[model samples]
Target: MDKVLLKYAEYNEPHESCTNTDIVDILNKKHSAMKPAASGSSEDTEMMGD
Candidate 1:
């Protein structure tokens, strides 16, 4: 998702358009319907120092 936004901003010219908060809100709404990953996986445990 971050990559997508970076690429969009990189290729597109800057203008008086959406702000950072606007982009965050848009991404949040777009992804909010998706299910999150499961907890307690090995990667997650390692990241949490558990």
Candidate 2:
């Protein structure tokens, strides 16, 4: 999905001192802190049994 394969960074021009690796590390930390939601639960489970 987008979460795994997607990645990018944003920063103010004044903060240009930040390196690519630093930005990626920060992003990784922020993302890892989030808990993954249950997959494929949005649809009707009853339909799958039919």
Candidate 3:
């Protein structure tokens, strides 16, 4: 999501604050280090068996 958001931001040019795209891009890119939810679920979890 962050990646998509950042892509949009870059496509639209710079801004004073990070746009939704930038925020989403950063979050998605940093997903691994971010905390898991209370249910301990994460995007990576779905791919574990692969």
Best by TM-score: 2
TM-score of each model, paired residue for residue: 0.35, 0.38, 0.31
**Per-residue accuracy of model 2 over 1-50 as CA lDDT, tens digit each:** 66654444343434446889999999998777652432344345656877
lDDT score for residue 9 of model 2: 38
Candidate 1 has which clashing residue pairs, if any? none
Which number leads on lDDT? 1
lDDT preference between candidates 1 and 2, better one: 1
Clashing pairs in 2: none
Candidate 1 global CA lDDT score:
0.72
Question: For residue 34, what is the lDDT in candidate 1?
Answer: 47
How accurate locally, in lDDT, is each candidate? 0.72, 0.61, 0.70
For candidate 2, the lDDT comes to: 0.61
- Please report how far candidate 3 places residue 15 from its true position, in Å: 10
- Residue 2 lDDT, candidate 1, scale 0-100: 95
Score residue 43 of candidate 1 by CA lDDT. 66
Q: Which ten residues in a row have the lowest lDDT in candidate 1?
A: 33-42
